[model samples]
Target: MIEWLATFLTSSPKPDLLRLVAVPVFAWAAYRDVRTRRVPNRTWLPLALLGIALLAWDIYRASTGAMIGGLAERERFYLRVALSLGMVGSLGYLFYWFGGFGGADAKALIVLAVLFPTFPAYMFPNTALPLTRTTVGVFSLTILSNTVLVGAVYPLFVTLRNALSGHRAPIMFIGKPIRAADAVREYGSLLQTPEGFSRGGLDLDALRMYLRWRGVTLAAVREDPERYRDPTSLPDDPAPPGDGSIPDGGDVVGPETTDATASGGDEAARAADSTVADPADHATDAEAAGADADGYDDPWGAEAFLDDIEGSAYGTTAEGLREGLNVLAAEDVVWISPGMPFIVPMFVALVVSLVYGDLFFELVTLLV
Candidate 1:
């Protein structure tokens, strides 16, 4: 069985063999991403190692002039492959650093850079694409361009769907509205603001600013010093939520209280628990107590954001969305992100690039 499997993978025309190998790998990645919204390193690391070995072998062949025909062409091909690998690796790392590329995506691009550096001659025997020629052997860029182009079509499809459905919100082009209750049940992310809550989405910039205002940085929080406590541990606030940011305090009526006296008693009870549950909430309550004593409106007295739920990448909790749902009790719907997996488009792009040699490049050439 091992011998037969090796024969099947290696016996075909080089292009066909490459496709056979790639399809299974790409399909698996796409499937895993769709199911888990994450790609484990175990899925791509072996492929990357395989790509490195193949590229090294290709280089050896080129250096020794062991080509069956057109030695010069082979050398150029290997050189282009090497250069493309370097360029893609550098850019992928940079993009990952800046959050433009997800972890799986950056690693996948690097693997592709090593594995499919050139347009497979067998797949497009008589191709005359100028972009192909310019890229030398680097087909991954073309694949990326083609992938983006193909992915763009889905947004248009969603827009048309929304238009036909009579959903007129402009933000519907990027995302659609659903019930906040359903969003919580389905683990969907907020796409828009609800009443009494700050904007629904996690604003990384705002979070950074909030941390800075509290005299803490992400580097410090991530390092997790014994004395650091939390990112929002300023002298004023003293302690914040687990994510190091303050929940938007508004008129939140807790179920345990009916009148101001009951709410105050509940707050006292909460102060006792907050030291253990969340010091930040306790601090906010202390501040609210002072404000109430001074006859000022207390934002922290509401306790609407108090329910704890699992945390998300945006640092908000399910409890936060639940609070938003409470505030939006008058509204029927909310906008949310369904967590689109990008690997699906990447898989499509891989197949498209293999068969068509870059859709974007072909369009550009036709226009020229």
Candidate 2:
């Protein structure tokens, strides 16, 4: 039985043998990464050692001009593999710098560098074409498998991870447009769009996407810090009292509150308060004041809400302030990214770079 098993194994192709050895390793690394959001150095350290060992062996063969393991020139092979690994490392850094992947992720890439060759090593120098039709067929099948898995598996994994995170983040939501109060979708966190906000560094698109025009003044507090400081409109925060640059006893009402309170007494006083207002928040405040002036009801207190939310709103209005801010918080409608998808600590691209060289990229890019 042992002789037969050895015979069967030796009879199998080298590419198949290599794959048989590699599949479990890649799978195990992926499993650890998914399970703990980390991959242990123990697993990768061996791989790094393997790379250094392979590199050394190749150096010996190249210097002697002898082929080992039936491969091509050792120097060419070593340089190619090292250069490919370097590319993978560079890609990982590019992603990490942009806020992708955790530290463990880059380490994993380094380890992977030792194992994968640029392009599939199965094809031989004997072949004249850079890629044979047979190779293309095999590559296509592999790519198809990977793409399908990513689409199906990753989302499920994210769902499972989020479920275990214990944060009770929202999963889905119905976006209802409200007029005046600060109605934000809780699940989206700070993931706002940059459409109109590129110029201001404010959250106008965030208001539109998450808050969605739902707003109401929670309070009518006359002495809001916002009034004296005008965070959004004023370029700088109020000078400390020691500087005396800040006016004494500045009215708390902003252009928003002033506009809402305009009918009460003086427009000049309202504008004179001269503070910046975020359109979404400002609209909510002015709407609250307008509603209060007209004897309407409120849910999220206007003064309290404004004091807490950061930044200014742009071009916000108050058509139906009372009804907008009434809906209570729910459990779904988006995902929370500490950073963002664009800024992840670990990404799948590194793995691809490890397995396939520039060819893999050119292939994926063409297909994608």
Candidate 3:
């Protein structure tokens, strides 16, 4: 079996097993990218390890004289593999670092380099394209270039589709409009205003958080202990008499005066001046005492600060539709980008290189 394997590896001149492994892996990546716009590490890591193991074994065989290929051929093969791996890895890192490609894309490219450092020898006779036959050393690079060429046509297709659908300019050329409701459900990003000039809408999420922090419910704003308190100005120690305010000096928001604190001296003086109070006035006095006890004078309470920055609908949250009401109407429009996943183009390029050779080579030939 070992002899047979050695003969196969030396005689074939290409990693046929690696090619077989790559087909399904690349296909899975294409599907994952299109559906989720992500390629998990699990998809590429195993394939990369397998390629590395195969290469290591080849090296071991060659060192021990178990490899059947001529010394020159083995050396050339190792050189090609090493060079291809380095070139592909460096390019992938550069692309990822520069934000030209996603991390998944970079990882997939490296895996491709490991798996197919050289083109499959079995394909040579059948490959009709001249570039495929000639450029066996840098198969991954050809795939990368081809992917770029083929991927360019997607935007054109999107533009044409939008034009035919009677969609307007700008976003129309980039991506077609789905119903705002549907768009919110989708993973795509909204291409519209982040927020409005007025208090457009409340983010229920922020409201909920504020409610939780304040320990208040929507049912009873008036009775909550934390209602009149400023969270940023809560004090640990009580204010001394005649001070009539917390140490922090944050006033309790109230209905009456903008400048808070009625003053303990004024309250004492008023109490002394009052001889008799009506039964109805007793309620007012008690309310005033309650306000004094809390050391807060704000009438509006924390509700005045409720105009918080709500979560945006355009980003990861998908909280609300941008211009959703108008978009719900038949005439209005909204724009969104259906995220472009890079793996689909990569898959196409792989197939093209296998069947018709490098796209750039063909283009050059046609031009010449």
Candidate 4:
């Protein structure tokens, strides 16, 4: 046992050590993604830098013939690393560009490529360390394949949960219904709207984030819905604080706005009149607001807040907020699809990759 432990600790090429270090980091990232649906860009920086440093050290050792197989092995190591980075790095960027991967997910994969361009080896008495590996042996690719395999089970779980709850629609396989009032506090997008069942409606989770970013709470918004809806009523506040900069006061209402509009002032009366407009005018207004003919308002200043942010970090747009708000305001119940946070499965894949190796490869080998 001591001998094995010493060998494990002193393993050459050292990627296994990095992998062990990454476990906790990946776990933290998954937690953040699950809770807030956002991971800070800085989260990947340390891992990326450490990966580069280790790669440099390995290359240096290989060049000096200190690597296990001398100069002959150096060329093979170079090829493997190049191929891994070229293939896996390109895939990660492409995934993000095509919207298949989030920015953080893509970054994680790219960093993994740099960290473990080739599989890191471990030894066990009864079993080989990696039960399966691909022909190319790109470790990041293995991780990605494992992630997909793990993520694939989520839909089945959703379906089973819905089935047990007596909701048997095809759409129920992807989402479930929750009270509209609770939508703000929940994690998902509205799957069913006033019109009908739709896959894309309002994202309640994003709404919650937007409100939190603005230093407010769902209860506060519910208390004075009309005040938040009126754009002109709000004070000229600066951009919403960045992530983790939530204002000192928790669950506090945002800056006070004029109550004139809520109290049936002239602007309020005009808004009321606009609601009764002819179909053509109503359609024009709805189009402008990016909502349907049914009344939609930015009750939490979501549109302005989204615009102020550099990018769609929360995976929502101003128009999307308006459309979602419209549904939340009008509906008693809304069907929502709580998106599966990919990071969670990615973390699981990391662990499985370290322990049991490539699950996809094993399955394919079994079938073949």
**lDDT winner:** 4
Consecutive 10-residue window with the lowest summed lDDT within model 1: 300-309
Query: What does candidate 3's lDDT look like per residue over 259-351, in tens digits?
Result: 211231323322322321222332345354345665434322332223232322112122332132222222234466655777888888888
- C-alpha lDDT (0 to 100) for residue 226 of candidate 1: 21
TM-score quality measure for candidate 3: 0.55
In the predicted model 4, the residue pairs found to clash are 191-335
Better of 1 and 2 by TM-score: 1
Candidate 3: residue 100 Cα off by (Å): 2.9
Please list all clashing residue pairs in model 3, or write none if there are none: 252-297, 252-298, 253-298, 253-299, 253-300, 254-298, 254-299
- C-alpha lDDT score of every prediction, in listed order: 0.53, 0.36, 0.53, 0.68
Best TM-score among the predictions, by candidate number: 4
Q: What overall lDDT, based on C-alpha atoms, would model 4 receive against the true structure?
A: 0.68
Worst 10 residues of 3 by lDDT: 238-247
TM-score, predicted candidate 4 vs. hidden true structure:
0.75
Tens-place lDDT digits, model 1, residues 52-161: 67666666766787644486688678667776677876777788888677788888877777777766544222232222433445777776777788778877877787
What lDDT tens digits, residue by residue, belong to model 4 across residues 52-164?
Answer: 88888878877888777856567778988997789888888999999888789899888888887877777554444666667767787788889999999998899899899
Q: How many residue pairs clash in all the candidates, one count each?
A: 1, 34, 7, 1
Worst 10 residues of 4 by lDDT: 273-282
Model 3 spans with C-alpha error above 4 angstroms: 1-14, 57-79, 123-131, 134-136, 194-332
lDDT of 2 by residue, 1-368 (tens): 67555654555334324433444555676655443333556766766666556556545655676644444445456655656556655655565566444455555555544444433443332331223222222332233234334434444555566556553434312112221222221111222122211111222223332121111111221123233122232212321111101112322223234345423333343343333344245445645434445342322233323333433232222211111222112112222232122112123432332244234445566798
In model 1, pairs of residues that clash are 118-137
- Write down the lDDT that model 3 would get: 0.53
